[model samples]
Target chain A: MTERKREILASSQSVLKEKGYAATSVRDIAKALEMEPASLYSHFKNKEDILKITCFDMADKFELAVREVNDIYFNAEEKLRLAIKLHVEILTQNLDSAIIFIRDWRNLTGTALEQFLTKRNAYEKGFREIVQTGIDEGVFNETDKKFAALTILSSVNWIVEWYKVDGKLNAEQIADKLSNFILSGLKKEMI
Target chain B: MTERKREILASSQSVLKEKGYAATSVRDIAKALEMEPASLYSHFKNKEDILKITCFDMADKFELAVREVNDIYFNAEEKLRLAIKLHVEILTQNLDSAIIFIRDWRNLTGTALEQFLTKRNAYEKGFREIVQTGIDEGVFNETDKKFAALTILSSVNWIVEWYKVDGKLNAEQIADKLSNFILSGLKKEMI
Candidate 1:
């Protein structure tokens, strides 16, 4: 992408983060970029198109983070911890992208919508597979894998809503707490 | 409230739900109610006042639901389940109010913001007390009580994002599943 294109996407993301997706308009983006409304047309088709791109880009980054974390760990417990850390780190660093992913993915329609749903489900399935691995290897409890996945994902996803820029809690602290809580729930104890 | 005042608030809520709080202007509410903008001033000082009333109404209903549920349950487990059930039921039934509570609470300034925060935090504290009681009674495992409270709240709170009007899972079903998962985490092993 050209510098201008990146700038437009970045500005659009900031606007979306501050005002949300539905409130954002082409005129708003153009005003933020200090360009005529038509200038945005050259880079992206419309507001919907920009949201679609942002959602897709966020999905890609999330998937890449999962893959990178998986490569670094072989144990199921360590993999789970690292995956949560990677997700929280990436999300905290690029909060705009995370907000777009959570808030605007539903705004997408037609083929763009389909593409996002597909990628999102695949990403969720990746997490589910890891949980299943932990369960089968006796590292995690034998529970409903899908529900566990959803519960974990929900907790992680809502972090973007409450994460503070200047707060004392870092991504690693959150990751450690989350991973510990989840593992404790899954670990078998002596009767 | 007078009949006209009630109608105005209801219309404001509907408009705010369809078009978020940030985007819903005073004119939009006036148009939705088929009244002149000047007439709305008789009921509300401005858009922020409408939001303040709406948020207060939402917080009241939420607290009522929690209190009603807590009154009927003697055990921590049952109280927790009832609390989750009522929270979801109230939210799903009045998605508009829920949306306003979730999204526009921050738009409130000054005394209104402080009042809403106080009520919201107090409401949350009710749940935290229930969790702490469970831990003291040896029904729940040792964990950060406040953190667990937030984790459970976040998991239940995000249901509004994925829940559907015609989806296979109704509000009751979703609430049941969530309550069950949360209870499972808190329940002591019988072995």
Candidate 2:
């Protein structure tokens, strides 16, 4: 992305996080960027175009983080822990992007909506593979991989709903706790 | 509540859900009820008053549903399952109320916000008890009860963020799948 486009996306994110999707408008985005509405259209066709770009950017960042974690080729247990930690870390750092992804991504219209959904599903596929690897390696118990993925994703993805960047518990702590809880359940422990 | 007060609260909900709390005014409520704005003030002190009443009404109904589950005195496992089901059921049956609670409850000011938080915490107390009971009975492994409660609540609360009454998964199915996954994690079993 060009520096100007990046600046517009960041400002759009600031507005979206504070005012929310339905309440935000192209004029609001322009106001935040200190540009005329028509000027914004030059960098992005419209507000929806800006939103789609923002969503895709966030998704790409998340995917890259997960890929970096995957590159370690650690044991399934370690890989899962790192994956969880990286997920939380990126989300905590880019809370504005996370908020926009969680709240406003669904509002993308027509082709934009489909493209966002595709990227989201691709993002989820990484998590599914982690769970599958764990089970396949005999480190995790056998279960319905699809449901397992959904359950774990449900917990992790919803972090943005209540997670506070300045909360007492930091992202690493939460990731550790969540990883322990999930791993405990997945292992064949006789607790 | 008096009949007129109840009517006012009901009308306020529809308008709030449709137009949002920021946009919906007393005049909008009056229009919905086909009465003068002056008549609404007789039942509600102001717009915030109506919002408080509506939120409390939603919390009260949710509490009732949860309390009914508690009265059954199921084992902690069963209680946890029933609690999840009841929460989903209420969120589904009362989508408008749920939306109001999710979106507009923050508009509550001063004492109303405190009261709503107290009532909302009371609603969560049931789940905390279920988790504690499971731990005490050795059905669920002892983890951080508070964190576990928050995790479970976070997952369930986000359901409203995505659930559609007419969606592919009905409330019961979503409840069952979610409850099963959570309980699976909590229960002393292999995943």
Chain A TM-score values, per prediction: 0.93, 0.88
DockQ of all predictions against the true structure, Cα-based: 0.32, 0.26
How displaced is residue B52 in candidate 2, in Å? Answer: 8.5
Candidate 2 off by > 4 Å: A2-8, A26-44, A67-74, A139-142, B1-58, B69-75, B92-119, B133-144, B158-176, B187-191
* Share of true Cα-Cα contacts across chains kept by each model: 0.32, 0.29
Question: Lowest lDDT 10-mer window, candidate 2 chain B?
Answer: B17-26
Relative to the true structure, how large is the alpha-carbon lDDT of every model?
0.80, 0.78
Tens digits of per-residue lDDT, candidate 2, A14-39, equal 88887666667778877887888888
| TM values, all candidates | 0.76, 0.72
**What is the per-residue lDDT of model 1 for residues A13-48, given as tens digits with 9 covering 90 to 100?**
988887677766778878888889998889987778
Q: Which 10 successive residues of model 1 chain A have the least lDDT summed?
A: A182-191
User: Clashing residue pairs, candidate 2?
Assistant: none
Please give the RMSD to the true structure for each candidate, in Å: 4.5, 5.3
lDDT of 1 at B24: 71
- DockQ, 0 to 1 scale, candidate 1: 0.32
